[model samples]
Target: MKILLDTCVWGGVCKELEVAGHDVVWAGDWPEDPGDEEMLAHAYAEGRILITLDKDFGELAIVRGIQHCGILRLVKFAARQQASVCLHVLTRYGRELQTGAIITAEPGRLRIRRPDEKGQPLTCDIQGQGSRCELRRDGAGTYRLLPFNRGSSARQTASAWGTGMWEGIKGAGSAPGSTAPGGETND
Candidate 1:
């Protein structure tokens, strides 16, 4: 599967995904900083799954009625925990994702939003107060929920390193941290 990694998620996550045998590209590697809509279009055009840390793509998915591929939104967590959570989800549901599905990884849980429903995607009230992440679809859609505490089973961890070398090859101006990268910081 071809995957596009958003700038915020470009740190070391792409390496793991690459070892999983997926072709990955970073936003900074593109001709310019593709906005959410453009990134979604590019992913759809190329038949690639979009892996992002931004929720704005959710709105894009709804408005564009995109059905080509899926999106994987990663909720903020400790760096170490985030890596482990991502690997677990990828190993378990990566195959299902090939068919086009949206999966979200939060602090202590993972949720799958299936497009096989009757109408649009479904919305579920997320638990965990003060949670920085919530998964919601536009309307009625089926979802499979999984909850895991600490020390979950290990899945696959991509061994490929420097998968984001192209990022370094490109100038820092396009990187996520710079003022010119996106205009506004999440902070």
Candidate 2:
């Protein structure tokens, strides 16, 4: 996989991916900031997946229709945990990402938006699961991982992954502040 690491991503986030044989490049390592729009354009032109903490790319890709190869936005706050989550996502969901999937990551769970046969990316709402949860990008380029809530429509897509899966999805035992039982409920 070809990966473009956003400037905000932790340094080591690329190490494990590189070890896994993915060609990874970082915006921070570049001579200067490529800027968000430019970076997205660069990644798309090169057919590289853009991995970052910036949720604005969602707006760029989904809302604005700025095409991209794919994107995976990590939600962990700490640097170590962020890198760990990156490796975990890549290892567990590599293939889905390869063809073009929009993935959002918190500690234990991932929210994915896959592409259709026509190769157009689907919006969260288009998947019949948009109400599940949403990642909101703040002013500083960080996303607030809203936990999944049990709503009238939300139950239709609720996890059948069981107790341990629930814990992992919620980041219950992994991180200190998060107590989400369903991995940052999408409320």
Candidate 3:
């Protein structure tokens, strides 16, 4: 994956992503901070996912409707915890990041917002763990669970549920208190 780490993200995250064979660019190493909007623009123009600890970028993308490849916001995570969660999400949600989405990772949970077929944001929350899980909302507004392939990564195992559930949001067991997705929140 090609990634752009915001100036606020821990510098160590860059090395971890690189070690995992991802192409990474850290804004901290830049000569100057280009400000959030410009940094977002650069990330979009370059087709890289922008990872930040800033909520302002979320406003820029959500309320201001800025075009972007993807944005992953890490909230309330310590500098040491950031890289591990970063790698975990990349492994589990790489496809969503590539295609475009605004994802907020807060502690053990993840809030993923993606453009629906009509281009309106469709938001979902995933929490829980144990085995790989698949999600779909039933007509009555309840989520129905199915099993995703245990052998392959979520992105690689993407099935027809693609339109309904997030392809492969796996467990966050690698991070403290993080678990496999078992629940969701519309808000």
For lDDT, the strongest prediction is: 3
Task: Extract clashing residue pairs from model 1.
Answer: 122-141
RMSD of each: 15.8, 11.2, 8.5
| lDDT ranking from best candidate downward | 3, 2, 1
* Backbone clashes counted, model 1: 1
- Candidate 3 least-lDDT 10 residues: 172-181
Q: Which of the predicted structures, 1 or 2, would earn the higher TM-score when compared with the native?
A: 2
Clashes of 3: 4
Reference-based TM-score of each model: 0.59, 0.62, 0.68
| Candidate 1, position 60, lDDT | 66
Q: Give the alpha carbon lDDT tens digit for every residue of 155-186 in model 1.
A: 11111111221111111111122332224221
Instruction: Quote model 2's TM-score.
Output: 0.62
By TM-score, is 2 or 3 better? Answer: 3
Model 3 residue runs over 4 Å out of place are 117-186
Model 2: CA > 4 A from native: 117-187
* Residue runs of model 1 more than 4 Å from their true location after superposition: 118-187
lDDT of 2 by residue, 153-185 (tens): 344323422132221222312122333444433
